[model samples]
Target: MTKKDDHKDPALVSIGSMFETGKIRKMYTLAELYPTRIAKSLGINYGRYMVKLNHPDKFTMGEIVRLADLLDIEPDMITKVIYAELN
Candidate 1:
């Protein structure tokens, strides 16, 4: 059985509206996704990107800002991840 709602275009729907309707987006971690794409965005090779991901302390402040922007996450989150090892 088809309804009027079935005819609606998903692309026309806003992300906020989807959230308001109880449809939440799944959040993924860096490790959960392939590193190649992120590496390409950062202009680094996969191997070196993986090294930075593992040892975040090696990242400079500029890199951290760039990473946060690239990942669409807050810089504090990256900061926490980098400093989490100390505590």
Candidate 2:
């Protein structure tokens, strides 16, 4: 499937919901999950910047993709909420 198709898949949609709902604890418990690197690369600290950005409120698809990339997740994993707005 194309990348855009993956973004519209139900599974990835659910994953993005986890992010939107602040269920990060569960998601981050996975050993492979790591968003800190992306945050650092972007010169941000997830905790501080999230608070600064008022996360769960101001998140954009582009921002989500950047975070997902840092966490080694596919952009689709974090785009469910912003996809409509993005398109």
Candidate 3:
């Protein structure tokens, strides 16, 4: 996906919603618990996109997978968590 196409993905809003409502804080906690794997799991873009929030964290559904792996949960659970918070 090109840089321009990123803005078009609904997953962008999903990730943004997770962050905005503080749900991503749990993902952060899981990352913290497994600090050693942080580098491989989060990588450079995690920081880059976090502030700008356009890092394509949802690109290829990677963020959801990452959160699921890190939290010892499922990707669907991540979506459910973020969605639940919205309501």
| TM-score, per-candidate, Cα-based | 0.58, 0.37, 0.37
Residue pairs clashing, model 1 = none
Q: In order, how many clashes per candidate?
A: 0, 0, 0
Q: lDDT (CA) for every model shown?
A: 0.53, 0.47, 0.45
For candidate 2, the lDDT comes to 0.47
Any idea how many clashes model 3 has? 0
**Deviation from native of the Cα of residue 5 in model 2, angstroms:** 22
User: Which stretches of model 3 miss by more than 4 angstroms?
Assistant: 1-40, 49-60
Residue 86 lDDT, candidate 2, scale 0-100: 38
Q: Which pairs clash inside model 2?
A: none
Candidate 2: count the clashes. 0
Least lDDT summed over 10 consecutive residues: which range in candidate 3?
1-10
Worst 10 residues of 2 by lDDT: 25-34
Native-vs-model 3 lDDT? 0.45
Q: Which is better, 1 or 2, measured by lDDT?
A: 1
| C-alpha positional error of residue 78 in candidate 3 after TM-score superposition, expressed in Å | 1.1
